[model samples]
Target: MLDTEAFRDRMATLPHDLSEYARVQTGPASWSAHPHAEELSAWALEDHVDPALVRTTALLVDISPTDVPHVAVPHADVAQLVSHREAFVVASINGEATLETMLDIVGLPSGELLAIICSLCARGIVALDRSHRLVTR
Candidate 1:
């Protein structure tokens, strides 16, 4: 299982607006890049599981039971961020967002992001090191 605390902590380091967007959008049924989302969705649909339950289950993919307080993103900063894609990109690269998170941050769809990430990983622009963290060389 993915480490929820670590995941949330990493996400917390993103700019405030992005973090809030992530938190508000997060729930059991919210979309996930996790490999399990499709299978879980299919099962829920086929079995007629309560949509709420399905959503809750989906939220479990990245949520931790332990509450970690999040730092607020100032409105002014968020406003500034709206016009600064370069800043966001730099921050993401510095923060080491996973290929999936990086794609979301850059507003690319999953397929395209996956392709780019795969290509970069292959070329060693981004690589998983001994700690399983993606790093740029």
Candidate 2:
């Protein structure tokens, strides 16, 4: 398993508000930027997945069987279907959104919504909130 506590400690030091799409941490050694870094961070935190694991998983998404364990989000299909904007929007209101609100905002059929959310849940991108509402991580 990933060192979640250590990852959380590292994440706490980052700027809460970032202007870029991606930021990479090289374990106190170096940092790089990605086009989807911030979005990834938001998704990971909300879902309770370690942010470092998210980054590592994203990097290995295209490669089969690398040293690191695989993560389910950032998959090719999921990436094609969702954008950073969608992820950000989902993560922001996941705590408060009702099914009706989500239907209105996403403008998708009920079946589609269920399928998309199910896929997200499988990938650890979305989860149930304390109130049992669907929330994105």
Candidate 3:
């Protein structure tokens, strides 16, 4: 038999926000996303993904099983045909490559790619290394 009374007691003791997702700024701008809000990640930026991240950021393997996880938009439920342009960015992040170098080498327009990176950052799959690389944390 299920213990409904016990379940109610336990639920009452827990904080309301226990499962609440944490809000994070997508960039210096007003964009935001809740990494833990849903089973699948979703990012909703205001105007666009920040460019400075592209200028000064490099991605490191965080939640990826390998140094490079398939460079998708963090597996979110959105539509934009954001292809795997950042694979080079992720593959080259040997803790030595810089953001500018990735952009130059990949040679793709930086907007969608940057958004994908920022989405990864927001989702906690990757983080910006202070030493100028992305990393798992």
Q: Pick the candidate with the highest TM-score.
A: 3
For candidate 2, lDDT tens digit of each residue in 1-137? Answer: 99998898878465566534344432332222656778767774687876645644553342221111212444455446566654533543434565446656766675565444544544565543334433459
Off by over 4 Å in 2: 1-94, 130-137
- Clashing residue pairs for model 1: 28-55, 28-59, 29-55
TM-score (all chains, Cα) for each model: 0.27, 0.30, 0.32
lDDT of 3 at 133: 35
lDDT of 3: 0.46
- Error (Å) of candidate 3 at residue 43 is 16
* Number of clashes found in candidate 2: 5
Q: Write the per-residue lDDT of candidate 1 for residues 1-137, one digit (tens) a residue.
A: 99998898867353445765766778555556667989877875696776545544443343321212121344345445333533343344533444445555668665544443333333323333224433459
Candidate-wise lDDT, in order = 0.45, 0.49, 0.46
Which pairs clash inside model 3? 60-134
lDDT of 3 at 114: 57
Clashing pairs in 2: 21-37, 22-37, 43-137, 46-137, 47-137
